[model samples]
Target: MTRLGYQVPNFTYPGVGSDGLFEAVAAQAVEAEESGFDTVLVMDHFYQLPMLGAPDNAMIECYTLLAALSQRTSRVRLSALVTGNTYRHPSLLAKTVTALDVVSGGRAQLGIGAGWFELEHDSLGFEFGTFTERFEKLEEALRIVIPMLRGERPSLEGTWYSVHEAINSPAPVGRIPVMIGGGGEKKTLRMVAQYADESNIICAPDEIPRKLAALDEHCERLGRDRSEITVTYQTSAVIAPTKEQAQAELDAAVAAIPELAARAGGVILGSPDEVRPIYERILASGVDGVTVNLPANGHVPGRVALLGETLAPVVNRS
Candidate 1:
């Protein structure tokens, strides 16, 4: 349901350290709300992701940061970009998001995915199962989570998780939209067609049409309305006042996080004028929403605001 979202996936920045990091994050959230971003998200990871920095870089727990963010700003929806399923029990995750909804006055969404960070699991003492096993666990977890979100106390005897009439008491004030992030055609898209209210995918700009078409086919096979699920692209962007400046910013970004340059998919770089057409093309492909990775420049004072001011209208128009 969110048309435009901003993600703060990193905490370490040029001048801000751990002592003032959360305050800086809170400031970005407030700025995002003021600048027309509909939702604010933090990455649900234990370590700083490889592209961003070393594992030991300052990474706060996701839900804790979201709870703190709820107090600092009003109106913007809050969520993790996608919570890794292996880290917590399904019932606990359901309760946590519900609590977030209650605290934020019903502005909460649950974005979840099959756990991917093996290193995080290994270090945190969670089971690092085979890919098939992880997806199996995610399937079972959703059965428990979706029912609880809808106010039903589901009893499930699943292979990975079992709950006997798990009650989510003091239920959330409203429905918390469930967003599943991933683009696996056979497994993930099938699950999205069956259970998710939204799907977030990362792909090359030109690959969007094919992905959306595949999702449509999945919906048709499941007898689900394609319109029922909002399709959002997860991307990274570079923006600046002028074309040359934007390119410079992007070069600096790619230089710092070489992964951005290596993996060109889902990374858009340019000034508003240049970036607008790419958004237009993607929106024309029928993407209903977007959530961007802005960690590289998001901590800078006006960077988030500038992004919102420049790109929000472009997205909204398309």
Candidate 2:
């Protein structure tokens, strides 16, 4: 269930240009693995989202980057932070992630969600459906993806999709865990109860207990045990050797993205001594683990290492 995962959502590094983009990403992936991160995720987007930067900012295709990452690292699980279900065909995505599992020695996880970035869809000429339509597509997509992942050829005809005994060959070496990412109370959690192996909730720390309780309700209504699903949280974080430096990093982040000021409480800050208690509280709240983006200083070689060596043990223990 991803004990301590690291996500590399920002591709725009300080010194690395386009030519060295992958090298920079690989460097971080390797460092994350060395730092005790069990899973490493890259966002699935054709262009950088507004939260990160402009549309023209460096962004790589998700499956391609993951395939490349599979070659660069041996142990860490590779996947998209959450694949946009609208961008590619469900059958094709099944094959892609299966290939990733094959090449990465079965250390691949499929993290997917209802596609949400309108800009990418409009610019890339993909259908930008309404929210309800996207969720419908996601539910349909899971019907196809789950069976294919289990080495089945499903012939399905639904309101949103159609497949005729579509096959996935050279299937995953072992069962590839499917993670449905979102915090939608009604639809998303219900889908997780019915289908997903894991669920990633993205919300403020204060909101986690409520989210978990809602998920539990969804599971009970579906006659499923909540324990069947591994629950993880996704958020940005700031960690340093000292509290002052961590605060400075947090301040810089908030200054860069003014909206972050309000969400600062959710961002893990300060030294390991300080951060561990925050993590402990999160764990106590029933969160199985966390996936963090260290965009502020991930490019700095040793920052990830310090996070791993200092904070990982605490999370692991929890």
Candidate 3:
């Protein structure tokens, strides 16, 4: 069956931008669990925007939030939508995730991607390499991380990172799924075919079919089944009771995110009945899961509840 998931924003800069930070997240996690959402995902970004209050707002750290969140919600799975490779050493990352898995009782999944957003790197003074260099770093980091988690002591020297005898203790007692982020067909998908347990593609629903074909090609090249990697997405949305309410919500969301709105047109602005077909179309693209972007603040908790309780029920899977 196609799995359904939800993503809390990477930036806390929702409208009326208070550093509500993750204080609201704990509540949403509970709501998601009760509503039957399968996975509760959070985006990884270190900086706060103007609307989010300040450049360095009252944001909570991801690992800390995850720890607290694990305690708050019993059933739902938790993960970063994707962690940045540049933020921590691969060894440290693997170690941290191992701990999270242990505490969460095997409920942790690690999603990582090449780091972008030059502002965070520059402001924090972490090395902000070129895009190509970041991708290279991610490859080596994944290599170092996965093996260490499996109790293999791997030694590696790469352009960006090197580890020798980096021991990850109390190895992930479960599969500890690793999801590579991005739909960069040439580079990212190739990495997923060889490395990741999952990969994410962000596009309009119509664009997913072509990307899936490319992923299939990558799978063939790796002599692996495309089914081996779970395909997921970050799609726009709006859930309201009536056509007028949906339109009003969409209008508010667009005003809040003029750029994102212009880039994507309207979000999934409709009632559950109106929106179910959009999800069905997504499944037709061979997607096994989806992580709907909680693009707005006021609406997100309610929308997440609706998705778990309503939309997920009608999605047909074979």
Candidate 4:
């Protein structure tokens, strides 16, 4: 499980042009690995998320970036924060992650969720189905994907996806951890209890308790121990040398992307000492770990290192 994961969700840096963008990203990954972070994740989206910036903002393909990061850093596990199930077939998705695992020397984790971002789906010609339909597709995809990852040949005849004794050759270097992301109590948590090695709860700190309880109920109902699966919380942060500096950075971020302010209440913003207590409070809520994104200044050269230093002790203490 990733006790402290650093997510690189923003690709547009202030002065680093497109030519130097990848080097900038790789630097952050290296810094994260050198620091205390155990894993590095990227968002699986085609366009810049609406809340982050305009659609045209720099957004690279997820797996390609992860595969590249594998060569730059030797320790940190590589994965998309959560792959959208609607983008590719189950068999292909499994094969892709398996290849990544092989190349990364067995440090690969699969994080998946029901596809969202209706704009991307429509624009890219993927099926933009209703919420229920998307979940149905995700469940079917998992049924096929899980077996394939375990080196089993699974054949399924389902509405959304079907495979005939699909083979996953050159199996993963090791057991690829499966992480299901979302906080839906009924369907998502139920699936997580049934098939995932980890459950990433995408919510604020105040909601962690309820999400954990819901996951527990599902695990109990399925005759599974809640402890069998690791639980990780996902949120954003803004860190600097002092509280005022962090606030100023956050204010500038909100000014550039107005939509960010709407979710500002949930973002953790402060210096190392100021935010440690907040992370401690979240850990006290029963989450096994946390994966935070520094949306405001993560692309800056030493920011991820600072974040890793600040949060590693708090997370390791738990």
Candidate 5:
């Protein structure tokens, strides 16, 4: 379980061009590892998310970045916040994550979800199906992916995917925990109960209780123990050494990306003393852990470190 995780959702840092982009990313990962964060994640998308920036903004491939970060930092577990299932075949994904686990010396996890970014799909020539169709594909993909990750040769014939005695050699160095990301009551949470080792609920803090109840219901229907799966919450944060500085950062972020203003309530914004209780309240809502993406000033040196310092004690306390 990831008690505290840092996500790198933006790559367009000020003053750093393409030549120093990877190094900037690497520096944050190293800092997070040293600062008490147990996990580090990156978004899995070919193009920048519209809520964050223009389509032409710098965006690196997810797994390649993780594989590279694995060499740069050794302690923090690495994964995509969630890999879009429609982007790759199930067996191949299992193979890729298994290789990541090997290279990372058993510090790799597989975080995945049903594909959602239609613009990326349409631009990249990948099939962008209906919501129902995408969920169907995700279900079929999991059936094949789960067994393969456990070192079994799975044979499956389904509507969206098919595999016959699929082989995944050089099995993962250790168990590669499957983390499913989403909070939909019907399809997403049900799939999380049935297949995933971890469930990342993407909702506002006030909504976590309802989402957890939905997940509990699914676990009950499936006759699976609720404790079998770990639950985590996903949200954005903007923290500074002082309240005024934090507000300035938030204001700047909302100015640059107007969409963020609409979702400001879901974001944690303040200094360490101010935000610690916010996180405590979130953890009190019953999530086993939390993963935060620092979209406002994460690329700035020591920003991620400060976030980890503030959050690690709050989340990891016994």
Candidate 6:
């Protein structure tokens, strides 16, 4: 199945307390599941970025949101966009997710990647180190996280982390998919091939074919079937009624995110009809899924509902 999922970055809002944020997001999450979205992701960030809002804006902790989302949505898989390796020990993360999985009735997956947001690290008083070092810690964290989740005895004495007798009380019944997020070639893909059940990439529609080829090569090196590791890419989609309107919305969003505008990769800016061809193009790229990051203006729920109500049929047909 060419599954379609929605990613909610939980950008921000003009809210003061958790009541408004929780009610709003939970409503959307339930709507997403009923709308037929395969999964729902909440961003893992300590603080809202400058682009989104001030540092102390309406933001919920990742795990707390996941716990609430677990109770609220029945079918939609819930996860962090990618949790920081530095935030918690692998064993603690394992136990947390085990309880989440149990509470959510096995509707949880772990989306983990090397942490990159410097402001989040600095603001939270987390040690912000060099990229290489962070990636190194990510590699070590994966070693610990995977084993603990699999009910294996985990003992790792790496440069960044050391854990002995790492364990979980209740192991997840099914292998909870470990999703690695990044578009890097050398280190990220190699590690995904070695350990991950899924891999996420960010690139233009034109670049996907090549990154996929690299991932396939990495799979071959690891002697794993490319099909076994689900292939999914992250894309920003601006949906409008007409081509002209969609382009206008795209311009508005690009103006909002100049850095993203400068990058030509994975922006699906068009009406549903125009974007239909793009989804077909990605479907032909040998991926199992496509995660559509919709516009988070007031109509996010409506937009996602429209996708599930409208575009999802097309996605399934492909």
- Per-candidate TM-score against the hidden true structure: 0.94, 0.94, 0.88, 0.97, 0.96, 0.88
lDDT tens digits, residues 4-106, model 1? Answer: 9999977877666788989999988998999989999999999988777678878889999999999999999999989999999999999999999998999
Return the top candidate by TM-score.
4
- Which regions of candidate 2 deviate over 4 angstroms? 247-266
Model 5 lDDT tens row, 1-318 = 677889998888767899999999999999899999999999999998887877877899999999999999989999999999989999999999998999999999999999899999999998989999999999999999889989899999899889999999999999889899999989999999999989998876789999999999999999989998999999788889988988888788777766567656667889999989989999999999999988878887888899999989988882
Show pairs that collide, candidate 2. Answer: none
What lDDT does model 5 reach?
Answer: 0.90
TM-score of 5: 0.96
Please give, for residues 1-318, the per-residue lDDT of candidate 3 as tens digits. 116667666444455245565557777787777876777787677775333334554455777788779899887777887888899999999999889888888888888999887888898888987889999899999999999878899899887788888888887768788888898989998998999888888866677888888888989988987777888877766676665776776566557555445533546767778877887777777788777755554345575677667656644242
C-alpha lDDT values of all predictions: 0.85, 0.86, 0.75, 0.90, 0.90, 0.74
Q: What lDDT is reached at residue 181 by model 2? A: 95
By TM-score, the better pick of 5 and 6 is 5
Highest lDDT against the true fold, candidate: 4
Total backbone collisions for each predicted model: 0, 0, 0, 0, 0, 2
Residue 258 error for model 6, in Å?
A: 10
Off by over 4 Å in 6: 14-17, 241-267, 298-301
